[model samples]
Target: MPARKIKLSTSSKVFYVICYTVVALMAIICLIPFILLISGSFTSEQFIRFHGYSLLPGEFSTEAYKIIFKTPQRIIRAYGVSIMITVIGTFLGLLLTSMTAYVISRKDFKYRNWFSFFFYFTTLFNGGMVSTYIFYIQYLNLKDSYLALILPMMFNVFYLLIMRTFVSSIPHALIEAAKIDGAGEWRIFFTIILPLLKSGLATIGLFLALGYWNDWYNAMLYLNTETKYPLQYMLYAIQQQTQALASIASQAGIQVQNLPSSSLKLAMAVVATGPIVIVYPFVQKYFVAGITIGSVKG
Candidate 1:
């Protein structure tokens, strides 16, 4: 009555071992850089200047982190701005993307194909950077606005298409049954479709969150106020200032000891990346499922 265990042939065992070895090696290779990054961030600036980065820290120090945290108020403000932008953008993006995808994926929608094409065409061609800047600044007057950061990344064409594919995979009969129960479009979407699209929502939401969190380009272009800078831009500004200080010191024949330039870069990365790394594990199952399902159909 017990299930029989399958026996592997010698060649099969060898093949299994090879596959496992290759995968393990690839995973370790990917992990090595991150390990070095963390190690280098804690390493003393003098040691790093004398010898390049290594897997382990040589003469451990927190000077890089100390330099970064010197302006604690600014760092906290930047963290707040980044967090607020990421949360709001991700929520709005997922809602808008899911709605658009659901509408387009409906079989009975009269102009679905034409609307899809219209969206797809924009991806192929766009107004150049000069025109876009003019429009955002001159026309929209979104200069120095948080919307500048959120709006550009909120509704990606590719994410919409992926959501559409997920929606299309749902059986039409389920939707029809909901309609038969006299449920309105809004009701059906909220009560039926939204619950069923958990994996898809999590996948797109994470992408939107990452985009908003990492965005510094739109901030540089649109924002003039130092108070409005996000975490990434704040780190970038600090790096620039450090480099400038080093340059001026060199020109004046004065050596700037303990500049922390190389180590500061690694420290900034650790700060920016720590939150996402913590959050990813929670949604990883949904992310993998959504990717698999979305890819199957399209």
Candidate 2:
């Protein structure tokens, strides 16, 4: 006979309802700031200064958008730089990381353990920030260059470990069977193994892309040239100029065409944040499934 399903008790139903309520409340809490930002971005500086930002604004204005739109050239260039970095970095990082992990995942390979050790050793120790900066800036001469942003974080230790674990969990029998069919290591990996690593690839690629998109630190240190500044750094300069730098500029007798700084901040933030927000929903399905699958043993 088929087993009968157990029904939830009244107490269990109440607990479930309470859990859902809590989750909904938490979601609202998280979404509140984003909503406020959108609202504030559309509001005039006069309204914000008089009433302050609230969930619902007393009045609306496109002044922020106006200021932000005024400098179409800089915003477009910043977007271009950020997009190039994100796409190229994600692709290359994923490829190199997966390859390195594959080489270290084989149980029977004589040097597998040693190769794993070499990768892991990097996690335990790294050149200090100062030393690393000096090497890249002074010795390597990568400063103010696009390579400055891409090369430093190309192969992450944690990412390599995750990929290694995922690849290692693939059934060893598959490799052995392929070898019996006269398959070389390259053929076995390309034909028999890599197909199973999709989950790991998606997960790692998403993280790498997000890192490249949101990164301002690299741009700050190495990218002094305005032409090469990424979106975050460009927004940062526009934001900073409202005060400290503007005072210096004023003292230096540089006449600055001041736009509505407060509104422009909101507009810039929206521009910077919009792409990821749109991308997140599409990538989210893969993100959830990939993380769950990659975390468990195959």
TM-score of each: 0.83, 0.83
Q: Model 1: per-residue lDDT, tens digit, 107-147?
A: 89999999898988888899988999999999899999999
Q: What lDDT does the true structure give each of the candidates?
A: 0.84, 0.79
Estimate the overall C-alpha local distance difference test score of candidate 1.
0.84
Candidate 2, 112-166: lDDT as tens digits: 7787778778778988889989899999999899999898767887777778777
- Against the true structure, candidate 1 reaches a TM-score of 0.83
**How high is the lDDT of residue 140 in model 1?**
94
Which 10-residue window in model 2 sums to the lowest lDDT?
A: 244-253
The pairs that clash in candidate 1 are none
Best model number under lDDT: 1
lDDT, candidate 1, at 202: 79
Error of 2 at 186 (Å): 3.5
Clashes per candidate (backbone, < 3 Å): 0, 0
Q: What is the C-alpha RMSD of each candidate to the true structure, in Å?
A: 4.4, 4.5
